[model samples]
Target chain A: MSYHLNHLKELESESIFIMREVAAQFERPVLMFSGGKDSILMVHLARKAFYPANIPFPLLHVDTGHNFPETIEYRDKLVEETGARLIVGSVQEAIDSGAIVEEKGYNASRNYLQTHVLLEELEKGKFDAALGGARRDEEKARAKERFFSHRDEFGQWDPKNQRPELWNLFNGKKNYGEHFRIFPISNWTELDVWMYLAMEGVELPSLYFAHERPVFAREGTLLADCEYIHKRPEEEAAVETRMVRCRTIGDMTCTGVWESEAKTIEDIIKEVSIARKTERGGRTDDKRSETAMEDRKKQGYF
Target chain B: MDNYDNMELLRFTTAGSVDDGKSTLIGRLLYDSKSIFEDQYDAVRESSERRGEEGVNLALLTDGLKAEREQGITIDVAYRYFSTPKRKFIIADTPGHIQYTRNMVTGASTANVALILIDARRGVLEQTRRHAFIASLLQIPHLVVCINKMDLVDYSEETYEKIKQDFEEFSYKLNVNDVHFIPISALKGDNVVTKSENTPWYDGSTLLYYLENVHIGSDHNFIDCRFPVQYVVRPNSDDYHDYRGYAGRIAGGIFKKGDDVMLLPSGFTSKIKKIDTFDGEVDEAYPPMSVTLLLEDDLDLSRGDMIVRENNQPEVEQDLEIMVCWFADRPLQPRGKYAVLHTTKEVRCIVKEIRYKLDINTLHRNEEDKTIGMNDIARVVIRTTKPLYYDAYRKNRITGSVIFVDEGTNETVGAGMII
Candidate 1:
């Protein structure tokens, strides 16, 4: 073996390489961390990108304000750990500042609200590059994504008009005010990230594993019982301790959880290996329609 | 199943014609191996209802694009991820039609193996030869030819043996070493996940078993260490004002601290002092690692500068002989020059020679035909303005492969495997 459990090291080297390119090619680059496994992997990669040196760039979080407390706690601890600047583009703050208005009725999610806040953050920071943890295998639209995905000033992606990313030579060159959404892990699959985490011994939020929590059934999904999510009056709210964990974390309203008892990375790997459900299945935002992810992606929703 | 300690990824591309049972085979693998999620199965059932399909549409899980659903054709590459108990897999669900060979090449570039699907009723078709040749040209080491729809032929051992013999004789001209043939009915779920009881004549591991047990650990080029610097890590903060790290992914081989390395094109030598990530300084760095490397000797290195073993240097030349898969809707004109990108290095190139265009099927080289269209494979020489550090495609895939980008349209016109 070249190195014991070197998958993470290899993955880490690739991410660091991408991160360094972002800093050199763009005037201002922001790491769009959402406190998820992929983004967590992104942050961990950034640490290696500039080891013996702090993360040169700032971390940008487009907070929907409907996130789990544990994820936020994990995010804060990570930010504190690296000493990198944290820029929060808060949806709640945006609503308070009259920059964006919250939805009123049932089926409302701040997940969509994240777009406006994210665009505003890019405009405010004048960031030329924004790194995301988007993987191609996760979604169909993402499968058509480029490594240096170009975004218009309005933050729109015209899937039809994408540049050819040949070999490893990425074209990071862009006009001023035009930002790029770089996905270093664009080639990485969901299982690869989980395996890398296990190999690297990277810690994540407890919400990832199977745990007992208050949940309610909505549209054939197990949604965490939270106040921000609009629930119908007739819907029954029951607090049952069940083994469940989230495949993807989003605004508490939009993200769903599956009944799983995978507590460790090994257990999760086994569970993932056997899982036929797409990770986005638990994501309520994606369950809206067949092309929900595509529509959102086109509208600059990450 | 016991030893996964040296697990390495095996990405492969699948190419076949429509109704070749590509989707069915993949679905069978997923279903038998139980990779499908409960909700995914539920959605498949619901979609099947909407489509009025008699059985669950396994294609619904993989064919995620809407146009593909509406048109019943695959236009772009669809990537599917599945892991067995032993190895992880990234299956590039490329289109079978000739029009989408560009997508196939993109998928095949990183693949270690290629699964060529053929209908048992239509053995040794033109498209089958085309894909197999493409796989061989791309230097994919393993080839698993699945003779699907065996039930149509009544699972006759004679039919299987005849087809295998014919295929072997036809493919003898190509340099494919690790080749295996299997008979299965993808629709009936035979020999895909579990061993088929009907196939008493065939005594081989099931498709899933083969996929899981394949020896892929040695697929990577571990002899030559090459790292292309992507960005210079400079945390110009007061806490560490002097920290400078060269960040990049290792293109091939291994790297460790105190190892003497040289930067490419410039030939600047430096000793690797440390390899580290934000987590901490690591002991070593190797192929595919995304790490920041600190060098002891101060050197003028930037993005695109390759850090390689000072001793084992690759061929540095301006003229390149390559086998390329033409991928543009516009026909490749004679002597047309474009931007050639290999690894991180980019250089303007001139098409030196068109050479002979080979018919993918029949193994016939048509020297008379002067035109090279979409999905056509041909041998050609290219002259570059600057020197590139590369190896033969047979040696190192990462450092050997290059792509021709149309300068005006900025489209990747072709993917070339260096000779």
Candidate 2:
């Protein structure tokens, strides 16, 4: 018998170990669910971490109110099927209560505004730990993120003064009123996530597969033509139905759609293996500036 | 895609300063392997051109943070991932400056291999010695020394041989088991992903080929059966009212059904009734695999308890001699009390004595001055409040290591390996 575990199995075990650590270490931990593939994978691992018992934590979703219709439907179905409690923190509620103001421009998105709502929800819930689905391979700033990332009382991140993490021993000790943003899938790559999902036969939203959607070109990216996005004068003429799929699931206003004919999980696996662009290449939120993700992360964006 | 299930994962660490072409070597690996997406490459190229560089500066690829990009130095460890058809690789890129010894140790803690880059123009520098010392101290299973910048020396075979010999002589004092030497030019992409004909005297495999085919299957400990319980799973539902499972990631050895195991700190013995995973029941489990074990008898157990084979029990002692690496700005005080975390157990420990500090650069023991400051490695004696079940760090990396947490600030200030 070969004692070697394949890359996917190794990754799975690592993630499960991290989840169990969080469950044992923190008092009130919450799994931050975004209805994306990474968050879906996190829920699956959480179930595996403590098999005999239900997921000991609630799933918090900071609803942007600009989500794809299919995403919300899938999120509700998954919450019911897994028997996990769902906590929604609405961005619209935060906006209506004068907690945050909506941005006004042709390219305005609620992506940045979700940070305020999330922090507020976490504070209200008194959650000691928030498990996110951020991967190191997704962006530049995330590459230096620790598995147990610490946040100050104000929910800000100080990248330069992070505690050194050694081996499998993670130091989750923090001061009062301060919390941690735990990333169990920090070591997984985009390809590894896809492979695991395929191997487990996990289901995803319909937006991930190819379909005819009305989209318009904005800065060479195909943005879904929806009521949430305030298109420019020139972009209005470019709206047309095309076969497309979403590489990443964000707010409908910011997530880019790829023009492709591949519709099945197998097709996606083959496409991602040889793809030239990164999954984040189509994310308009990262295109705001070279240091956009870094700045937002420092401000406590998931 | 067909071989995805059979692919293995190998993690390696690289240490170098700004001028050692560490960034260029990493960039070459990712680029040649087609792991760098077009958008990422375009961003790097644009940033390079804006700074008036002649061509795309590969050094900008690994520098992620804003301050690092501005100061032109890596302040912390950044992880990078790439893969060939045969294996997946994770690179823990760290700075080689003497001040960043803490970061280097953190990266080396989990690496299977260490890649030490030696500039060919400067045979073996003090920085190279420091990197080798840390890798050896961390007990990395393999080491690959790449003599970079062969193009600068006109691909001289004699120059490469002298550096290799000097490094070997110095490494003899360390505890490294496997070491390989390679000649390459990271800037010009020679012997990185593919073999270059510039050095006809060299007959070794390329850097990528060596990384892909390195023997790392035996790196884990399979002789001592040890499992540190992390959490206990109990469901009080009607269908399974009395189910109690001990959950943890196996630290070492192989545990099978019907194996007689002893619980640590309690010394109670029981037989393994079953091994459970998310998928289903399994007959046996090995190191690094997280699984739940059900004992034949309901024994009183909780977190911080270790389950090991009866015959291979670890040493349980309150007094420990450890090799300490200080990581905090505040110097380690004599007889200072802090929280020590080993495996799943946390206990308060006091520094009993400061055995001499080891000078990492010279590999000398300084017995006169015993002040342990930041980035200093020393041999110290500590006494914990409770006895800890552990092995020598060289025997089991997972079960033998510990971290000291500052009680006041709640920051991890030190890491120690059991001696």
Candidate 3:
């Protein structure tokens, strides 16, 4: 008596199918967990993908060390709950080791430096596939990404020379050292993510909800006043107590918090539906250049 | 009640030449459906103004890559997602040039509908026929012939009818099940999201209405039982001991507990003890469902194994006759060895012979043109190292399709549909 699946159900099933393919194809696969809503959703889907059994893959967190405290706590709790292995690739360690130099400025972030650390981690772990929460609708460059995006031995993404992914069949075959960056939720938009979150009742970091946090204004975006961010003196940004929430979570210096009264998932969905800009519109890292994402992706940033 | 209780999904691909307004039509669909957010619209507007276009170019919304925007053409396939209250749609927007035939095939392979745009003044062009033929080759369930630029033809019913008739006659060679025609100007927002007052004589559902209402439930094969085991789920933990579930997405037919099933390549028979989903164990499972199956007997099953009904089984042969759409730039070499990927099974294969190359324009077979180049469709015979379990593509799409991979480059060189 069953008919067609609803949109959310269809998306879930599609994601589950992809997750299973990753498990079945690659020998060493890892879920890229950012402790954001998108990555949280990825963990949820991966868990469901191998239900009645623990996820065969480990959760790799490319930790920038500029994370919100709540996100780290939630990430640890999630790992404990799922019993999935956690591997942290630290950007701070990369900076400390002088492998990647830390940028120094008001808009300085560990975002770009994450590629070197991530690639080093991937090589060390010998992971053949890294499942990400990247959605195409988030950025223009991402829209051109394939579900089974191949990365060379150097962990570089060739936007022009990607394999044509036809149908549900994703070609995960690659050379010995070359690997694939799998995006199961590449088709999901920000609003769809919210709708799915509300529908599934998935747990997320508390930073996503509205709270009175000390924030400073920088380039029309609200930046959380944290130790990781070094504000320039000329930049007239004073710490203010405003009801704010994060649309996306990343490095504390790059991820922006927006003024909002919407605290719950339903409220977030409503706000997202009527929101004028994309979720990345609030991100300062993408504002560095039009092809910022493309450039970083070329260097293997997940 | 869940918000997505009754929501469904629709996957469609758009095809047209450079100036046939394919990008504009997709833009209009997204724009009129309220899927276009302000920042995205503003970005496109900014780019349009920077390019010195007088009016805001809607096509800029889809030309995402910098090279595409610079050349003003879609170079590769880009997937777009948007939704209405009734349905969610995934649009596989592909380039229209003959050089990009591989892109069209890649996009159309998974789509339920093929939205082929035809310029009203130009009628059914060669690109239209090529797109329709590819849709047929891919077995896309629905073919939507959007007669775009109707405003250029004054929205004349006679013009629409003439083109529709020409398309129908041309489509006679195609194997698509549902054929629909709509005349409208995607640039003008007519009969796309709303009924056009200009086309009062035409009594049909709008493009959006048709997309939201198209029946896609029966598109998958449910009569033939075929399940390819993708992975074996084993939890060596203490809580649940000795739990072995075969994990895979059901390719065809339906399975219930206690149903008699047989494993391919091994001939091991087992009864379905339980159909497990993420939610819980379900009573029955059908095609395209990713689930775990707990069998009554503990059988040694691994990846590349197929599960089927006791009575019905797919063809197990080492040699296969298939129609291949070559994707690589290098021409196919006779007796060339390749890595064949079919239904989670990877096997070494060699080209046995080239039957004939298909002339996409004339629908004729040229037996002399044995050297198939990139984007060329030809009947090819292949011999695999091991016997592959599959059904004819016409009967079951999931088991029938296969792709040839270049072992050195690991690139998918050709897509094959078994006869």
For model 2, which pairs clash?
none
Error of 2 at B228 (Å): 0.3
Candidate 3 chain A TM is: 0.98
Give the least accurate 10-residue stretch of model 3 chain A, judged by summed lDDT.
A231-240
Docking quality of model 3: it rates as medium
Q: Which candidate is the best by lDDT?
A: 2
Q: lDDT, candidate 2, residue A272?
A: 90
TM-score of each: 0.89, 0.99, 0.97
- On TM-score, the candidate that comes out on top is 2
Once fitted onto the true fold, the runs of candidate 2 whose alpha carbons sit more than 4 angstroms away are none
Model 2 share of native interface contacts: 0.80
Tens-place lDDT per residue, model 2, A274-300, is 999999999999999888999999999
- What digit string (tens of lDDT, one per residue) describes model 1 on residues A235-288? 544545678999887778888898998999888888775566789877877877
| Fraction of native contacts (fnat) of each candidate | 0.49, 0.80, 0.64
Each candidate structure's count of clashing pairs: 15, 0, 2
For model 1 chain B, give the 10-residue run with minimal summed lDDT. B1-10
CA shift of B252, model 3, Å:
1.0
lDDT of 3 by residue, B1-419 (tens): 24445767788999987789888888999999988888789878887888899878988887777778888888888878888887778899999988887889989988989999999989888888889999999999999999999999999999999999998898888787789999889999999999999999989989999999998888889899998888788878886688888888888898888899999899999999999877898888886778889999988898899999879999999999999999998998899999988997889999999999999888999998688999889999999999999999988888999999998888899999999
Candidate structures ordered by TM-score, highest first: 2, 3, 1
